[model samples]
Target chain A: MTKLLLKKLTKTFERRVIFKDINLEWNGPGLFGIAGPNGSGKSTLVKVVTGLISATAGEITIETDGKKLSPSTAIDYIGFASPYLTLYDEFTAKENLEFAVNIRGQQLDEAKMDQLLEHFSLLKRKNDFVKAYSSGMKQRLKIIFAFIHNPDMIILDEPTANLDAEGKQKVYDLVKQTAKEKMVIFATNEEEELAMCDEIIKILSYQPAGRN
Target chain B: MFRRALWLFNKDLTSELRTRYAINALAMFIIVTISVIMFAIGQETISAALAGGLLWVVIFFSAMSGLSRAFVSEEERGTSLLLQLVASPTVVLTGKLFYNLILVFAMNMVILVLYSALFDAFVLKNVYIFFFSFVLGNTGLAFASTIIASIIAKANSKGTLYPVLSFPILLPLLLMLVEITKRCSEGVKFEDIAPEFFALVSYNVVIAAVSYMLFDFIWKE
Candidate 1:
């Protein structure tokens, strides 16, 4: 139902090349992974995929239901979670969720909210300010936030960075359930997590073609 | 977009209540500056024009202190990414602008009351004109400040950049506000001050339109 295509993608910061000449096409429903060592552009590639940062050069086209979407419109289809992204620390978890949902113009799906909270074991602490949450709890909250809209494309960078084993299992289960009918892109160095992907792209592979 | 803006406004209000960041900064600057001015003029009667200009000077600096944090705080807290991912640029801009508008209006009303009582600057016949001018002026201030806040949010030296960017853009608006305030103090008729009103309204519309057109690039970049 959704497809993503990147053509000759190049990204550079201050004349230092991050990656170049990347081309790929992905169609959901499946799990895709972007894997690389640290500083190998794994995060940058994920950011590019989610439109969080502009590429130095290239084109990204997202098609849904066979309609090609412009970059601005394509953004609505993406849901992203990253260690770099932050929630409102001053707001309670429920208030944060409400704010996110309201901004997206979606009705509050209380059933889904209850399920996610119970699944993450956060139902009791939903009224607590996010600043009070532990890093693992915050990670679960971020993952939950990404799925709030049930977006056509979900991108998670360092998805399990600080999560405990139990949290990791919850995330893996959520990804499996999500990728069954949507595009899920995970950018991580962990081989265990990458093993879940149907396909993997090493970010290093796109490094300035043939330059060694 | 409007609904989203309201939601953001509420979020800002609640966050402000908890942290007291912008409000505390604005309140401190306002109280300190006004008290200093009152002491400086100790028993010295100043002209309406001088009083009007001083009022604007206090307000402009107070706004510069508080409104710059509208976007800067988001950037510092890393919440801008969350907003960028979930909301459109227009929606984000509208939300920030509304919050700034509420802050500026409320702060200005407090300043107006204090200036009137403390400095004897309320000797005007046409109070309605003053009220309208204050509303329109704050609207323009809100528009310019919100956009500038976003511009400076990404800069390395935000504290310096915010005021530098705001000064030139707000100069004309400030001039018009000062002129209108002076006229109001003198009990000038509404017809005599229509041009100033028109200028303030036009300034708000132009700044808002330009900011809306430019915000997508600024916000995403």
Candidate 2:
């Protein structure tokens, strides 16, 4: 079980407000969505929540299994997958996964690796260089990389960005399966994707009251 | 963290072998610079001090060419985010630092052999001082270069920013290296260069400690 609470969250870029005064309490073991139109601080909010970027003024308290986590170790419990993140193309998918697993000081578990590779339909091509994989395949590999460590919270920004209908279905199914045990923050505006969420948080673009 | 750093080192070694990006740049730079030096010094006898100075020039420039590749590759390939997500800042910095250390040590040893082979004045009567300076110099070079490389990787003009940042930061260390090299090649005894050895070790420690403290912010931000 994981809990995230954001208090008075405000983000500004060079005096230009992106979002402000956003307070939310999010709990997981269920699917949640952060829905916003394009350029409405969706990715920024996602990045902030994941501690990839700092909030301008707010507090993000992340508690997993009833223990409060500091910033340094918060990421240890987070599995982040996004288009903004990429795998090493110079490496084969297997080596890339191995590096990812090993870099966290955890040895790669062959059985879990096989299960994830098969889940993403990447088992057959695990030995192939990621450069040779299609974008959809690359996206699948990213998903496997994220889940390999069995993180407490899984955050996916624009999760279905490059997927075909079949790939999208696979993701929806995976999310369904994952949400049964792990917290999934699905950041997207797609109606179909949002509909699967147990709750949706809207982020509207910020405009000052006096501005036209 | 140590094991993870080793994994990263191996990953980098594999990538470097396949791409040869830094290796080619370093090789070409060394060959061209040495050739130019050979031409410039033709028919004129130079002191070992001057030879030592020239050798360090090659080292500094070679590092400028190759060392930044460690962090810059992560940025260029868009794998920086993945790395950020997977590892702690300490892990990332330690791992990259190890890779850079290996590169600096290997490149300088190659430069040392090549420089020794090409110059008649490059004598080493005090092998002990040369040994101490060589090891310490390479360590300091890698430490300072690793931090600066991470900085320049974030800059808009990466190519120009590296040397512009490295030159001033490395000036003190480079001066000590040249001085020790000159003394070593001139057959000065090892005991006389104690102060140089101390400075070199301190330089490496200070850079390593400061870089460790600051990398978290540089990396996360």
Best-matching candidate per TM-score: 2
Per-residue C-alpha lDDT of model 1 across residues B105-202, encoded as one tens digit per residue: 99999998888888885466678998899899999999999999999999999988888999999999999999998898898998999988999999
Model 1 clash pairs?
A: none
Scored against the native two-chain complex, candidate 2 gets a DockQ of: 0.80
Positional deviation of residue A79's Cα in model 2 after best superposition, in angstroms: 0.9
TM-score of 1: 0.96
In order, the Cα lDDT scores of the candidates are 0.88, 0.89
Q: Put down candidate 2 lDDT per residue, B1-221, tens digits, no spaces.
A: 79877888889899999998899999898898899999999999999889989999999999999999999999998888888887788888888888888899889888888999999988888888788788988999999999999988988899999999999999999999999988887788767888888999899889999999999889987
The top-ranked prediction according to lDDT is 2
Interface RMSD of each: 1.5, 1.2
What are the clashing pairs of model 2? none
Report the TM-score of chain B alone for all candidates: 0.97, 0.98
- For model 2 the TM-score comes to 0.98
